[model samples]
Target chain A: MAEVRLTTPISEEEIRKLKAGDTLYLSGKMFLARDEAHLRAIEMFDEGKELPFDFKGLAVFHCGPIVKQDDTGQWHVVAAGPTTSSRMEIFQDEFIERFRVSVVIGKGGMFERTTAAMKKYGCVYAAFTGGAAVLAADGIKKVEGVEWLDLGTPEALWIFEADNFGPLTIAIDSHGNNLFKDIADIAEKNRPKAYEIIGASKE
Target chain B: MEFAPIIEKVAFNLMKYSATVLPDNAIKAIKTAYEKEKSTTGKAQLGAIIKNFESGAEKSTPMCQDTGIHIYYVEIGADCPIDDLGKFREALTNASRKTTTEVPMRPNAVDPFGSNSGDNTGRYIPWINWEIVSGDKIKITAFPKGGGSENMSTVKMLKPGVGLTGVMKEVVDWMISAGGQPCPPTVVGVAIGGGADIAIKIAKKQLMRPIGEPHPQKEVAEMEQKLLKAINTTGIGPMGLGGNITSLAVHMDYAMRHPASLPMAIAVQCWAARQSAAEISADGKVKYLHHDIKD
Candidate 1:
């Protein structure tokens, strides 16, 4: 797997070259927007309202993070874990197409719609480590701000400036390669042999 | 013997501790998983999970944003003085409030009718399963069930002739198909031979066993090892990045089944398998099992 470092205002072309299993260390601004924020953005697009922020080249993280205040009362993310990425399958394609997002970061594999959209839209889907919220937060230099308080803290949009924010792997690339599907195919081929080994072990 | 009050207190504390501790297990498993994972992608995901758990624990945070449905397995003694289980239920509701705020668990309980409880407790504060035993002590185990892994659990009612081979295929297929959806590396809990509902219950209960522990019965132990190997061989790996180890353990609990049916249930625990227990006596003696909470 190749490792690439990303800075602010990444080009869509750069995202297209990423392949499944390629590691990326992202330093720059990334936006946090879970289901509610996504829906809201879609609503805004439909209503012709001014968007919350510029959407081009933005990386949207699928997360609803837990927040806590420190001894100094500075709010910090306690566990900013990625929610299952597939849950956003219905909206990902449309969201990417409309927003021109350079990257989509979350856990698990995305759907065919997302992968196809990424290929067409010059974007990539990155799989962040599922449970490593603390390590993910360590990459955050500061939280720039937040939006959608009514959506609750978890659903709110958290904007952060990050430094080497990932060891994120590109699960779905612009070339139509999907790491999740590839792995599944390999596993399925070995299923019968796996069963045989299990049988013998049981005996 | 006025068992309602005591039951209430026990259930209440159980719910509170369950929310906080269950994620601890998730964190531990994920960290271990990251270290052992061979897949580059899987290791990356495990690293993220490790960060998530560390942040949750250090910040007194909830491990997953989804705090999950609260499930309790209650083992009540026959000689216990508590006559009414209802009071314990009420106590559980009260405890749920403290847990939501203290553990800062996500408020996941929503009314089926579109009303949000805001607090974790609503129609069912804590889902309860009761086991009446011939004893004087009451023991309760709490599993804070997250939606990701819970969504992956499966149950199948097989004819007796289908036997162990059929069971193995189903379990492995279901999990390998799950890929990274359930957040690997997962702990697989298999409940075999019980009736439909009991089988599912046993599967969930089996997850309470510590990682790497084997079944007491020799045949069952062999089955557990076999399933463990088979699942790992799927190469679903840690976080589905593709690796050598997909599962940390395979735990099974069994009960006698009907002559014609062999029911099997698979309960998958995400890397973050959060669970805790509390045992209370009629004289007010309390023992904390599994998770150790300071203060």
Candidate 2:
């Protein structure tokens, strides 16, 4: 796995090289958004209206973080951990295609539709640790801006510049491989033996 | 003496405590998992989660942004003095507001049709399960269950002949399909041999067991270990990023069942499995009972 640093304006090619199991240390600008923002984006797109920001080559993080302000009025992320990505599965493909998003950062693996979208659109789905919000916050160099305050802090869009932002692994690669499904398959194969053990123990 | 009011108070308190205590377990488990994790990325992720929990606790913040829905399982003593159960409900509703402000749990309860209850308590804000026991002390266990994990729970009824093999197949299959979706690595709770509702209750109760603690029954203990090993072989690993530790534990609770009906339930507890217990005595004394809480 190659360790590459990403900046605000990344290329689809940069994302295509990533595969399931590859790791990345992302840098530069990234946007935070979740269920609400996704719905809003979809609405705007369907209405054929202009979006608040450009979406091409952008990275969207599936997170609703708990942030705190320190003594200096500087905001520190208390828990900026990733949310479950599969919940976004329904909208992910359309979101990627319409927005030209290169990387989708979140926890958990995306579904088949998302993996297919990744391969077709030259994108990748990378997973940061689900519960590791504090470490994720440490990757942020600055908070560039914010928007959509009506959704509240957790649901609002916060723009941040991060340095070496991840040890994130590719859960869905450009080749359409999904780590989540593969693991499930392995677990299924050994299930019978597993039952026998449990049965024997009961005796 | 009515019992409803006291039951309500107990339910409310359970919800509050469940939300507040999640970070401790999440941090502890992540740190331990990191040290033992075989995969490099998994180790790194575990380390990050540990740091997050530390900061969340140190700052007195909720470990996760999703404070989750309030769910409580309560056992009331037969001899306990409770004049009004409705008062208990009122107390729970009132306590929910206090806990929301104190623990600062995210206001998650909403009216099904519309409208948000900013205080986190509303009609049925804290879901309650009640049981009457013979003792003079009331015990309450609270689980601040996240939607993600709750969505992954599964229930099935097998023919008696299908036996333990059927149970293992169904449980492991569900977990595999749930990989990373329920936020692996997770702790799985299995309840077998009870009626549908009771099976579900037992499954959730199994989650209260401490991580790595073996079940008291030798057979159950072996099943737990076998399932754990089988799940890890999936390579779903930590955080679904792929690793050796897919599950930290598998706990099960069983019950006697009908001759022909073998019902089972699997409740998935995310890595952030937060639970705490409390007991109230006849004299109105209260005690916090939890795995980590010390006197």
Candidate 3:
């Protein structure tokens, strides 16, 4: 679990070396999609419709960002931060396999199904600070464009051309290591102790 | 007489401020936690959060993509016209519409049957609550609550005698179970005394209080401190990566309730639980406030 700098079109060999808790900065292009968009993407895939963007070896951020457009119809990213990943857990494993995304960026961690997918599909789950929207945006070089505007801003698909876009930590890495579960174990051990503090309050 | 224009303008500014600026107290609490955090991941999360606040301010960008739902608390003077309340409400709705575009906020309000406003205005959105004050001035505070934290808010109703200990344990257990989904070191807001719904509303409201600002009641203040300590001890830490400061602060506010029931509510706010306040005088001159910014 060491800090690693990775640029994508990430090869299988590069991802397999990473473990949970490693700091990873991804320099490349990516796009954002939330729960609704994922559902749409899945349905679209099933129906054999044209998807808005190709997903192979790219990063998918779980975000619905605040974006603005100038008079010329160009887009600007006001703030782009990761959403809680667990909300997308249902669609994530399928997304990893169907999209073949090399990196998945979001926060609050994913569960066993996603960990298994990351292992099996050569993907890594990156945790970005949940509310660090503008800091996250600072890493973006351009908003290439957006799609699925019908989904609304918080759920729209915003395709971004980004470079070194992260302070993203690999919370669940390619090898099936899960940072959130490990932390949860420690917290579980401490819970009974914390409950004792509450009981002491009765006195 | 005509306070509509002023209300619209002030509300617009407040929403923008809430989205762009991290209440100074929240920033301070995060900095303090960053210093004391032991886990490298937790510390890095805190550091990224601090950077986010700074960048959001400098760029006047919405801090988090959620931009959450905006909750407004308005204080009005006794002398204000009774007929003007309707005008005030309209202004709130208008201001919310403008802010959605001006702040370039994400369209967050979708109706139950699955239709969004495209702008964030719905009937009750940019929800406003009113309080009557003695003086002839209007004060407004905006809390731009994000979705992630709001999802974790919980309420438990206990038999009246279940007591303070039961409330504390409920909060701790919730925090432990939450395990960073709300984004730690979160601000934990507890509301006790009212019926279940009111308690939940008050708990969400109290999340606006700055970190380290103690509850006014002596006993509640003690409980706040204790709850903060116990929750942190669980090692949920920042983003639940594990560290020393899981919760930056625990705040509680209460309302009188019936003797037979105890309703306790806890609301969690992410570190960027953006809030800002300002006031407009009778003459319609508006002034933004930061005295509540805090240590």
Native A-B interface contacts kept, per candidate: 0.58, 0.51, 0.82
Which candidate number has the best DockQ?
A: 3
Question: In model 2, where do residues sit more than 4 Å from their true spots?
Answer: A17-20, A27-29, A67-78, A140-164, A175-177, A181-203, B1-36, B291-295
- lDDT, candidate 3, B1-295, per-residue tens: 6888878877888887788887777778889989999988788888888877887888878778788786789999887554467788888888878888877778788887777787787868878888999877888887778888889998888777768888888888889888879988899999998799999999987787768799888999999998988998898789988898898889998899888889999998888868778877877767788433221
Candidate whose TM-score is highest: 3
Better of 1 and 3 by TM-score: 3
Q: What level of docking quality does candidate 2 show? A: acceptable
Candidate 1, superposed: residue stretches over 4 Å from native? A7-9, A36-40, A47-51, A68-76, A141-163, A200-203, B1-59, B83-85, B159-161, B258-262
lDDT of all the models against the reference?
A: 0.77, 0.74, 0.84
How well is each residue in A19-138 modelled by candidate 3, as lDDT tens digits?
887788888778898998899989999899989778888889998888888999999888888888999999899988888899999989899999999999899999999888888888
Which of the two, 1 or 3, has more DockQ?
A: 3
Error of 2 at B191 (Å): 1.0
In model 3, the runs with Cα more than 4 Å from the true position are A200-203, B81-83, B291-295
Tens-place lDDT digits, model 1, residues A1-203: 78899876779778867777788888888889887788999889988998878978978888876666567756666556677888889898989888898888898788789889988988888887775665676778877778786676767788888789887888898989888888888888878778886663322
Candidate 2, residue B52: the lDDT equals 64
**Candidate 1 docking category?**
acceptable
Quality of candidate 2 docking, DockQ: 0.42
Candidate 1 residue B124 C-alpha distance from true site, Å? 1.5
DockQ of each: 0.47, 0.42, 0.75
Backbone clash total for model 2 is: 10
Model 2, B124-207: lDDT tens per residue?
777767789998877877777876778889888888887786677677667767877777778899999869998988998887
